[model samples]
Target: MTLKSVIFDVDGTLADTEKEGHLWAFNRAFQLWNLPFRWGVPLYRELLNISGGKERLAYYLAQHPEYHPLSNDEIREIYRLKTNLFMERVRAGVVALRPGVRSLIGQCYQEGIPVGIATTTNYDNVETLLLRHFGVQWKHMFPVVVAGDEVPIKKPDPAVYVRCLEQLGVSASEAIAVEDSAVGLKAATGARISTIVTMNTWTYHHTFLGALAILTSLGTTQTPAYGTGPDGWGRYRVTVDQLRAWLV
Candidate 1:
């Protein structure tokens, strides 16, 4: 099958938005709320297994009853505040696209291959990162953006990826999904889409069992590409051509 479109996951796949972006924002929210709670790196890393921000917070609250008396509405509000803080930090230029991301996206655009996003992160966070990186007209570049709030279920469920494929009017066989974690890999493969795994700091330890390729990053000509999988193309930097070859 010919590759018709490329769908991307936002958080770790697009940029290191988890540790540098959302985790910081969540800590800031807790501080602002005068809550005696903070998510250190190890705890936040574990919490990332949960898909959504509010869901993660709810899980944390349940684990530690001391933080109770915090209702669902309060959790939602805290997540909202965290989103705002994340956007502010993004606007301040702390986050940047992963290696080869801009080049690959631009290549796809130049070749008339539509790019879409399927992320469990909220739309506002998506907009913030894209606008900061791709400018005010980022929506024109990414025509299909199915975010967390838009989906009933999150990754490891395939709902978000399925929605993205639906919005793009493309079948799973005709598109490739780029993900950064095992949960995301599950989501993409569950939708029957071929996927590429690009591991980030927080997710590097997670297993990527069904990935077509698992790499440190979508490497550029300037950077060495290193990966381990049944796919042989991991020896060098992955390009649009390599992705097409993997479509099978």
Candidate 2:
């Protein structure tokens, strides 16, 4: 079936903002709270495989309770602090939207295809990205946004997807989702939406067994092969033909 709407995940999928984006922000929060832990990119990747920033914080604490233990209130407070730091980094122009992001969204807009975001990030981050990438009024461009905390649950739960479908007024089959991780793939799959995966920093090695297609970027080549990595899945180039081949 032809796609009626397009849904996207914000972080690794839309932008390569994780370098100093997530890890450093978490560190900033950690320092402010005097929490004796510093998260690395590898650990951050594993954490992202779960869902929701708050959940990730909790999960990390649970896994390594000996390192630092923070109650739910404390976790929320620090994460809020982290969120602020992250937004500050993003606002300072430290991160950039991945390749083809602008063109793909433009294509969607020009073709009258509704674009929506189903992300685990807070609405503020989403809005910041919208303003930074599209324009200050970018939030007005899309009709639907489903954030992590907005719904009763997070990714892999399907609640957010269902909510997004409801807000967009589209059937699951009529919408397509773009994801960057296996957890995201599972979430969209659980929601019964066809998904296109774009491998990112830490997600480059995971299996995308059920994605309609997997690629490096939305604007590259229609059929991207294993480029220069040992895994043969590290690089890809997606094209309109490839996108149309799947979306159509």
Candidate 3:
């Protein structure tokens, strides 16, 4: 099947948004709220298993009922605050696109292959990052962006990826999803789309059972990716040509 589109996951897959972005924002929110809880790296890593930020917070709270009880509304407010903080950090240039990301996306655009984002991250956060990096017209660059709140269920469920494919008017077989974690891999594969796993500091340990390629990054020629498969491709510095070859 020919590759018609490339769907990317925002948080980790696009940039190291988890560690340098969201986690810090969440901690900052907690501090601002005087919540007495800080999501240290280890705890946050484990919490990442839970898809969305609000859901992660709720899950953590459920695990520790001894902490101050916050209603659903309160959780939403905290999350809103966290999202604001995240956007502020993004605008301040705290986050950066992963290696080869801009090159690959540009290549796809140049080739008329649509690029979409299927992420459990909030829509606004995605926009913030895109606008910060790709400028005000980022929406024109990424025509299809299906975010966390847009779907009833998040990753590991496939609803978001399915929605993204639908919006792009592309079939699962015609698109490739680039994901960072196991849940994301599950979501894309569950939708029957081929996926590429780009491991980051937080997601390096997650299983990527069905991914077409699992790499350290989307890698440039200067910093080539080191991974398990992509059989015929050099497996170093995944380029647009390599992706086209893989789709065959």
Model 3 per-residue lDDT tens digits across residues 1-248 = 78899999998999878777899999999999999789889999899999998899999999998998899999999999999999999999999999999999888888988899999998899999999989977887799999999999888899999999999999998998899899999999999998899998898988889899989998887888888666844556767787878886
Clashes of 3: 0
Candidate 3 wrongly placed segments (more than 4 Å): 232-235
Model 1 TM-score (2 dp)? 0.97
Candidate 1 Cα misplacement greater than 4 A, ranges: 229-234
All candidates' lDDT scores?
Answer: 0.90, 0.79, 0.90
**For residues 123-219, what per-residue lDDT tens digits would candidate 2 score against the true structure?**
9888876777788657656778889879887887888888889999999888888888888888888889988887876889989878887776664
Structural similarity to truth (TM-score) of each candidate: 0.97, 0.89, 0.97
lDDT of 1 at 9: 97
lDDT comparison, 1 vs 2, better candidate:
1
Q: How many residue pairs clash in each candidate?
A: 0, 3, 0
Writing each residue's lDDT as its tens digit, candidate 1 over 184-244 gives: 9999999999888999888989999888888899888889668864466446577788788
Q: Lowest lDDT 10-mer window, candidate 1?
A: 228-237
User: What count of clashes does model 2 give?
Assistant: 3
Q: Which residue pairs of candidate 1 clash?
A: none
What is the lDDT for 120 in model 2? 82
